[model samples]
Target: MVLPGKGYRFHATGLTHDERGYPDMNVKTQDLLVRRLVDKIRLNADKIILVDERWMEDAKVVVISYGITSRVAVHAVELAREKGIQVGSLRLISLWPFPEKRISQLAGKVKSFLVPEINYGQICLEVERCAGGKCATISLPHMGGDVHTPEDILAKIMEAVK
Candidate 1:
């Protein structure tokens, strides 16, 4: 779900209906909104450390995931850590504001960032922007309703680092 700005509560279950009523035929505006939120969260999240995007150079790799997809990503991170891969994950509790600066910092330190999502491909763009060509970015996208497994995320992370 490509949402504009954070702190706004909008629900999106599937693609058939753009339930949030995104601005019509205005892709640029939509992209701008997404960026704005990303910045906002990055700046404001120091309190909870939820939206915080600080870099951990020793982490080696970072994984970005949300919703159900994120659940799997969380498991994957755990698995990777157990295997001594030195992985960490940022699970977006807030969707709109993507925490760009924090992500940018993370991008600089981590060797790679993996974005696992259910859509064809969207958030990958923002991940790239924040990465600023410093770190490689990879996407593990799933179109069907079948939930991705921890193994799925692990595979993508492995592929990204390799």
Candidate 2:
């Protein structure tokens, strides 16, 4: 689900809804279903949660971004690298069932994580939780009229390294 910038508009025609029957809401049945779903997600997490890590070797700081924001982050990471910042780029291709294990591992290795998102700090919260106070998690939030400039992300990356 791509959350576009504010004032971004599109027209969808001939959209059809698949009407699945109402979920079984009996307490016992619901509990069982929920447990099964959680198990399924856990079992497939390695396959479902996609993350792209770049320049991570010996990185002191990592930039974590998703959706459209990840695109901007790539340029910012490249610029940071050109300036010789020991920063890595971690683009989250799948947000749900988040890559907490990777974040936790990196937290122990890196000084901080910079999460720049078009929204006001959703994924950053998860990053912070996963870091578990092992390292700093900086939220570079944008209010969503448009995507953040690479310079903005680069500035945060610079801050994170410090």
- Each prediction's RMSD over C-alphas, in Å, is 10.4, 9.9
Which digits, one per residue and each the tens of the lDDT, describe model 2 over residues 52-124?
9999997999999999999999999999999999999999999888999999999999999999998888989
TM values, all candidates: 0.66, 0.83
RMSD in Å for candidate 1, one decimal?
Answer: 10.4
Clashes of 2: 0
- Can you write out model 1's per-residue Cα lDDT over 30-139, one digit (the tens) per residue? 57666765777666766535542323346878888877887788888888877878778887776555677688888767788888889886888888888999998887
lDDT of 2: 0.87
For model 1, where is the 10-residue window of minimal lDDT? 13-22
lDDT for residue 13 in candidate 1, whole number 0-100:
37
Clashing pairs in 2: none
Pairs clashing within candidate 1: 37-97, 38-98, 53-102
The number of the candidate with the highest TM-score is 2
Each prediction's number of clashing residue pairs? 3, 0
